[model samples]
Target: MNGNRSVPSRAERLRASATLHVFYGGIDLMVGSRFVPHLRSLERSQWYSREALLDLQNRKLRALIRHAVDRVPYYERAFHGIGLSAEDIHSVPDLANVPILTRESVQNHFHDLTSDDWRRRHPVVNATSGSTGVPLKYLFDRDCVAMGWACLFRSWEWDGYRMGDRRALIRGTDFASKGTPLHERIRRHVERNLVLSSHAMGPTQALQYARAISEFRPTYVRGHPSALAAVGKAMLSNALALGGVRAVYTTGEQLTARQRMLIEQAFRCPVRDQYGLNDGGALILQCPASDAGLYHIIPERAIVEILRPDGTPASPGEAGEIVSTDLHNYAMPFIRYRTGDLAVMEDQQCSCGREFPTIRRIEGRIISAVKRRDGTRVTGLVLSDAFEQLVLTRQDCVHQYCIVQNADLSIRVLVVAGRGYDDTVTNDIKQTIWSHVGKGIDVGVERVPEIPASRNGKRRYVVSHAA
Candidate 1:
């Protein structure tokens, strides 16, 4: 560490504050948003009691249900079909009476799901990354977008990050594509963000990113775990130092234990993992005061439910599918929306005194399910666990791997070889996969120089064509 590091002057701090205020004020005026207000509310709401939070959710749920019944064709028909009414769903528990909305239903009934008053709400269309092979489009009102930003900013505060803090964003190339709008470029510049592409993160690219980030001196490093791990590996291999980073935040993909270790070691900082879905309106962030694996759900953004296969609620420590309801997005409310992602429930409150509900861990998406020969499906989480075990047991043998399930129920294991990787390691990997997925299913191990990123620049550990 530099003993003579300088601190920002009072004038510099004031200037930064002014710039942040002006930028966000301009944005609010342009979009008629309430981002600042919402952020302030979230800061206070995090400390609310459980009963108070439940009241807030119930109030929001009532409003959302009334709006959906009155305005949305799909929800209106669904409610009426079962002889249900808005009055029936008076609280969070009452949501059980609402039909579960699937991704297929949203895609098939896109128009019907939209609110009749969408134009008045200034609705915007957004889509998921389509990592599962199909992207689902959804609507977001300006307020819903503001709330999303608020939720994100609130969670970031748990890591001691404030607005206008210097941060480096390693994201997909599409995030800052050549065709990006002029305003977005200006926003990135004004926000003091060093944006780097996660696509094609080879040794050269990783080194370049490392050098740029070191020079930039960002306090926060945010990216997908795989991309950050690749950069971290390069940094360690080449003895590159990135000083002044306080915390590394990972999203867009699950953060494996190995990836977290590599990132923390290379950056010399703690790693915080966050999970959110563009379509599901769910925002889950790791609690700074708790263990790394546990996450806190933002109650103001959405209502989250972890349910078993039979639509019953999963108990604490039990794994289940994630179903979410967007409390703010009245433009196109996704009531009881099945997110296709899995997570474990946590019943205990954090020692930090925050009442935000907790999730023990986020399992991978359901779309990454591999079909067995007998028509059974193996989840991505199982495969990920198997790979994690392999990395731990083999030491430096398996650097990176991806599982691709073909249409014929056959599996292809793509491996980026490491120090001790060879025929024996390959066979071991095959057996490991077979142990989870039944035997007699053809599993081929292919050694490759690199596993390419998807179109969205995310390195999916498991891809199932059968899904």
Candidate 2:
């Protein structure tokens, strides 16, 4: 007999594959079964080539349009009014034939926008409480919810997170209630995630949150950029170091370069920014292979288009309004929805093998400027930069702050005071604002319990009423 080892038989290989399926199946059961199909689909879709992905997109687009026209009254009317039919929109470019759906349209025809049959599938209805304007209510079916979570978790996996890996979230949710709710405890157990309340955060609270997160030994930390930066600043000031943190994820607010630097330096991890809307559409996430600020659009979730003021497609690196269409969510079809946000679309492919396209940067939503006494208009980002710079320099004095412009051209600065906060700090902030916005504008600083987030879980740095 030859002294050689024999290769494993087909039976043995089949047994090994069976064991893996069982192992992952058990984990899926623990995490909840709805995500199983969606997660697997996303895993497979990422490997698709550009042409294959677009082909898949076209198929989904056709199905979505057919469903919209057949079931949703609003789309039925929109298509008929434009002398277009579901058969006419066979590709992404054909989508332009259907006019853009504005927020006002959604508000005016809320019922018609939703499919009556989808309610049986457990559709959740909610409203977006944006910082600037009226809230817009929308519907997301059960499958849509699962798909969205799957895409979100896929992004988390880019930073080395697994199904049961521990993570911490600092969002607008009120987690500081007297006691945790039963459902919340169960949710945390199932998801293996913790929530730190952003609404109750201050200097003292930030220290507590930092300590709590340190104890949890979370694999990832996620929250609004400002809130996360504040906690990171607190950690740095107190010489606190959290171990085993794989990455920090920021969303729901515009993340500045300074915020990324602070968060990364304090946490000893990279910061990944995610952009999307609450209407169950437009999910763009930063992939592991992307540069510092680049994000990849989840092709399965939505089709994102950047259009110029002339209603034409913007060139690569040209800033334009972001118009997106949800490829899923047939319950409430949002075709050609105007997101009101601005971004630059990258024409180049990423080093990552994934075919998902990249967004160069997300400049915040379009809003009128705060008119000054000299007929000058100052945008929110410009004035907000003054405080952002302060946080960069004196990390201990200011944690989270906001600037609000009144109708009389007076400005009010709301400060969630941190360590070293005092009259001198207030005066410095006033002087900082005066320097940029010009004098004769009444500027006042007010310390508060917290700078509450808008209803949709966003902490806007500036709210202007003058414009």
Candidate 3:
């Protein structure tokens, strides 16, 4: 060391050392887990021709079918009951013979659905948030998690996300700076993220979060659409800015046009919405070059089918139920699983030149089922559409609402009042609900200041205490 050079302070040296440690540690984790290879493979696969993509999907489908029928008890019985063999499912269309796997089926046959060879693949157990109604526990292998993240990260790259870019995550986790788990802290530190709890978001907390975003200068923000929109609304009201955020990514809930507009206006960036099921059977992400409201399916990860109520395929532009087959979850293969969400699938290729299929719109989930005295059940989506239509035509009166079914088959409508709301709007909503739900069911409407979101930051339009 030169005698004339000033020595660095101990604190400065320690800070520099810590920063280097985090940087190297992050690199080690990324490389050691084989995520980089998967990312590269997915990036290349996204550019494959539609025919090529379908070919790859068919190959994976065949392998999954063989594995499922041989090792999974549920699929073994299902295939045999239909007098079909694994070889019978030669293509995507042939999967129709296999019975539709409902959420209830997975819940009831959790043990049977899980592969007997789960231990060999390092299976990890996880549960759904139960936001829709009932939570279901399932298993996934480490490779499934890693490859899914790789596919997701590749899509994020389209919106200018790079490794080590500062990110602000506003989701449904505890954001208290104290008592954070070691793994969570390490993730935040190494990935350069700031996690704000969605549960505690209010006007004051939004302002605080906006300030943090400005200071952090995150490259992007990711979270539930409603939570992000709330922050956006608060920021706009408070005249705050999310400094230099290039994009906003929304997931876990439906991204309405109003919410998208609010989020984009507040953040001064584009909003990219994503749709996925907890079962790892489906993933659809918005393409950067495409406009909002259009999501391209990640064909390499899952085979998605938009089927009619009768289980046949829905025509393009016609809304139908979404059934998906996970291509990678060998530990617990969810073949022909019915995701209760509805969507209108687009047959045409995206203008951006990608070969993946696009979904024109996602009509949220079916939500809770409303049961009647005779044991007949009605899906909550019917009541939800009624409220949606009322709000669409009469936004000035009905801001938001939720339908709750009680034990006695009575319906309680919790409403968030808007400007000029009165008895007329209330009566119309009640009548609409009654019309779809049939006669002899008591319907009541009550106004409230606000309707709180579910723990996972989802605003469930329907809740059933009866179920």
Model 3 lDDT tens row, 1-467: 11122454677456644654565445547544445667778989988998899889999999999999999999999889979999999887788888898888889999899898998877778887665457889987777777788788888877655566688998776656445787778878877899888876665777787777777888789998777877787788778766577789998877666677789999998888888865855998888777545789889889999998799999988878889999988889988888877778887677778889999877766446676667766666555655676666764676567788887889999988878688998888878887777768999999998787766557666766775
- The TM-scores, one per candidate, come to 0.92, 0.83, 0.82
Q: In candidate 1, which residue pairs get closer than 3 Å at backbone N, Cα or C atoms, i.e. clash?
A: none
Task: Sort all candidates by lDDT, best to worst.
Answer: 1, 3, 2
Worst 10 residues of 3 by lDDT: 1-10
Q: Candidate 2 regions off by >4 Å?
A: 1-34, 176-184, 368-383, 394-399, 405-452, 455-457
Candidate 1 lDDT by residue in tens digits, 71-187: 999999999999999999999999999999998998899999999999999988987757656778889887888889878877777776655778999988664356667887887
Residue 455, model 2: Cα distance from true site in angstroms: 5.2
Q: Give the winner by TM-score: 2 or 3.
A: 2
Badly placed stretches (over 4 Å) of model 1 are 1-20, 175-177, 370-378, 392-396, 438-441, 465-467
Q: Residue 93 deviation, candidate 1, in Å?
A: 0.1
- lDDT, candidate 2, at 379: 54
- Clash count for candidate 3 is 0
Query: Which numbered prediction scores highest in TM-score against the true structure?
Result: 1
Give candidates' CA RMSD values in order.
3.2, 6.4, 7.7
User: Which portions of model 3 show Cα errors greater than 4 Å?
Assistant: 1-33, 129-132, 175-179, 368-400, 403-412, 418-444, 462-467
lDDT: worst 10-residue window of model 2: 1-10
